[model samples]
Target: MGTETETAPLELDDIQAGALRGRPNPYAGAFLFLRIDDPQDGRTLVRRLAKVVHPADDVTDPLTQTSFSAAFTHAGLCALGVPEESLASFAPEFVQGMAARAGLLGDVGPNAPERWESPLGSDDVHMVLVMLAPNRPQFEQTLELARVTIDDLDGITGVYRQDVFSPADGRNSFGFNDGISQPCVEGAGIPPTNPGERPVKPGEFILGYEDETGSVAPVPQPEVLGRNGSYLVIRKLYTDVAAWRRYLRENASGTDEETLLAAKIVGRWPSGAPLALSPDEDDPELGSDPSRNNVFLYGDDDKGLKCPVGSHARRMNPRDAQVVGEIRLHRLIRRAATFGPALPEGVLEDDGADRGLMFAAINAHLGRQFEFVQAQWIGDGKFVGAPDEVDPLAGAHEDHGTFTVPRRPIRRRLRDLPTFVVNRGGHYFFVPGLSALRWIADLAD
Candidate 1:
């Protein structure tokens, strides 16, 4: 389950930030989904984008400008003139798409593609352009520039666009802090924020490097086409803030118990404090400290006395906890950001407003990392010794969900957990390395 010892330093300049650590979190951003109306024109747009796309090592520069990342769906690649043979090298799940494989990912009923946004599974969305800026004006400006650029191109069409933002406290609509448990990547030169985290092999999340198997990950050939590239799975998930809050209010006896119940479901406090270290109450100091916040392991809490095994955090990344396979093999870097407005503070009733997250799971080996975790861990409870249980936070429960909280004498079980999260839409994409982007632009088809 371990990778080979140190190789040489990674060529950070050649890799895109999305494939390494991730683009910096901007307060404002937009996701633009596009289609190729004319293959030649689309190629020209790719060529133009290669010049301004951000690289993995650019953040260190004080003068670095707003960031943009580009990724293509299988149809987008085909439209770009990539041969069928090359496309065949891609994982089947990616080629098939998220909605088509919903059963495997455990997305059923209201969460399935049949109920997703109109453009989600259509050929109308061939590529996705992600733009981010620290301020709204800059974000709007970048968005306008791309909008104009796409409009001017005879072969490209803007299919859809979704705006995103980060609230003051950086919490999701559910009012809990997010993006605190991202995995660190080896050879990326970024220090681990969590003391309990070890750098994951670059190949686990980035192609063209040794993976967990100690060999360069297999990729679509010619090497230039696949090198430094990675698979990106994006989803727009709606959070039922009213339902979530109501459940907390009714289940716990008081504020303390309510907060603890929430913590047990997430494996962390609203302030980001891990339950393994602070089970009864939030430790704001620890939650705010990068070194302390994510430092706890589940090994000590196997029975979930400190943190429930079926909690969202534990189900996503069970560090050192008992599992059917090596946890490292399923690691993925989360590049998700909250979308929609936060419910007014202290308001617990339904407002009929749409709110959720624009999630991006970046990984090198899509099958082993992203797909495996979603199918085996997040969608199934068998791994944590709870065969009938699903993730209380994200799972697609058949009838009613049960979350067992380890307590003395008799275990406390939270029953009838409704679907707090709904899948609005999602897709699979291939984010090429900087050089690969250039190669794609220069394609002679």
Candidate 2:
């Protein structure tokens, strides 16, 4: 890790709030995609957006109720007439976009880009606007503010929009608590939620700062357009709630066993209590406590007795468990929210509802952070010493996969695991800083 002498205080006022801060629980948000038909119009839209988008420091304001963040696709940058030299400086994955690398992300068969929704991976998608608020009214108000930026602008067109919200219970479509275990960014002024968490270097998530390797990563030049910026990976995943529940029921013997099976697969109970801390049963109190819920490490449970090494949460963040690579290098700031209606509880049959999660992974290095986690961790199980296993909850299981649960006397192994999550569509975006937004808007022909 970088020493204090090499690290500097973060420029919170220049950075976008979404890149560092956690969203409010039970929040209302929307993601809006846009296409730039003309460079001048796109610049005008960015100029207006720069005014409403909240800075990282805005979270301290008591009156602040909404946050607006703006990001541009590689094609969007080109549409705005970014110079060739500057464009070449971006991460190669971002330049190629998410759809082009679908295979690496396990987006094959049903999740393939060819089957993705229109305008998502296409070149027509140039800009993305994310609005988040604590309630419906505030969310709508922020949406209106964003709409005005492109109102009557013939060159800028709205492509797609997804309304997302966190349920009162804070569980996702799969009935497990989401958005837990985020890496604390150094000098972000926000203390670690868990005492066991060591704050990661700011450069790991924001540009122009020293990363864990004690070196500053090369940002897209000129520095004004890249400093304090970060990469935003947006993916729309559809969770098959019915399928997940059915698998649990079929794998276990009874009601108590069924719930245990579900918890084993996720590495946590439905209430967010991790198995490492509450091994026997669901502890709602422990799960609700932010400080204690994510405080446990996997060093003691290396044998997969409590939380299986191949479980969804464990694979995502190994946390001192001696995984294939250093866990710190792959840490990501996730801001994911559930979209569509929650399936009525206890319904094992398919409801045929288009419900899932809107996942946004924030980081400075696209290749080593977001893409690495997706391709190597979630998509495969080689890192955890389970070469054939994958993340049971989010992995692309093709109806023939298996999951092993370590236990006393005899171990339990689940066979024929079906794919529970499907990739609907997504894109890689470059979230520029406040000054960079203006620089982009003020670009000359």
Candidate 3:
């Protein structure tokens, strides 16, 4: 019995653009999550949470959910207060009861196994209540605002919720244009994505309401592999601008950063044309163009020619576009972002500190979606031409030095080092809806 009301869809693109321009911090948030117990009964919990958050209107469509996001102020990353959290606001008995069930009350140790990822991440809270939307769904405004006020009360600051533009373009510290080349939604068969192997549909990742008690499943047989399961891949990426620059300047004899970065990191230039098309060059306008960005694939002949056999995009989603014989069934939407500040000027200032992306993705299944990409393409060099080259962009080959991946066979090892990217910190989470949120509040003291 889920229903939605109507409201003007809030523009995530514009909102992201504004944040990028102004450098928004991530302190103000009303993060709600399923109470540890709520999972036992999502339906009931959903109604209760919805009642509190959507008293004014039906929690209805995503637009309403998004608009309700538009409200109020939040603390910045450099805030100086620690506000009251659920545990502090809720009754001690209830808090104690749920904490016991969650096994948190039993473990007083600083480190707990139940936790995922390291450093600050999504697990710190459940559903994030951004105060950007308020019209369509306003019932939760009070609870959301209360949370922000609580954070303000404490001395904790927050970073901006990371959401970028259509293509997430922005300049890194070294100032070279970044966010240039990203993977298309694979089988979108639409703009932004290349015309090659299409990505699976978006609905596959979120809840398929119709699936609960529907006629036919969205993709025919839900019992196969993808069903409701979503693949969650976590990567702790580190950024090395100076090293990247050094590579650019050294390789500048033939290629420039503008050309090289896109090729190595994105497997294609900015134009969306695969390097398989132009191995030794770049297409800046092509890369930046929305209309013509994604238009190539890894066919047998065009394979090693336009794009390197081991290109990031190719490795991630081989464009032969083949699936379940020819089902072409998978796509990885990178719902991730960069962390840390621009690298400081001095070369030596690179203290190996923070400066990278916390990459995350949602998929239909783990094996078909993420693991297959990583194990088959990225980790295995045999797929391309070598045996050791993982994804230059996301590979975790520590042995690969400033310019070389060491201690690996030439056939298995890399010769000319590719510091496509560095890892920093990250984690994965299941993003539930408004209903799952109250469960979290109920868990609080």
- Give the top-scoring candidate (TM-score): 2
TM-score on alpha carbons, each prediction: 0.95, 0.97, 0.54
lDDT leaderboard ranking: 2, 1, 3
After TM-score superposition, the amount by which residue 214's alpha carbon in candidate 3 deviates from its true location, in angstroms, is 15
Global lDDT of each model?
0.82, 0.88, 0.38
Candidate numbers sorted by TM-score from highest down: 2, 1, 3
Q: Could you give candidate 1's per-residue lDDT for residues 302-421 as a string of tens digits?
A: 898888888998899899898899888889888777888787866778798889988888988777888888888877889989888888898877797999998888889899988888
Per-residue lDDT of 75-131 in model 2, one digit per residue for the tens?
A: 999999999999999989999999999888888999999999898889999989988
Worst 10 residues of 1 by lDDT: 1-10
lDDT of 3 by residue, 1-445 (tens): 1232212222222121111111122111132221122222322332343343322122233323432221111111001111344124222322222113222211112212234233323323222322323231342454555354434222222332432211124443334333323343312222354545443433333332221122212321222111222223444455676665565565545446445554655566544445665656766666555455556555654334445556566666665733222223344555344456666654533566556655555543334445455455655566565665666655545565222221223412224554545433222333223333333323322
Better of 1 and 3 by lDDT: 1
Off by over 4 Å in 2: 1-6, 61-64
Instruction: Please give me the total number of clashing residue pairs in predicted model 3.
Output: 58
What TM-score does structure 1 among the candidates reach?
Answer: 0.95
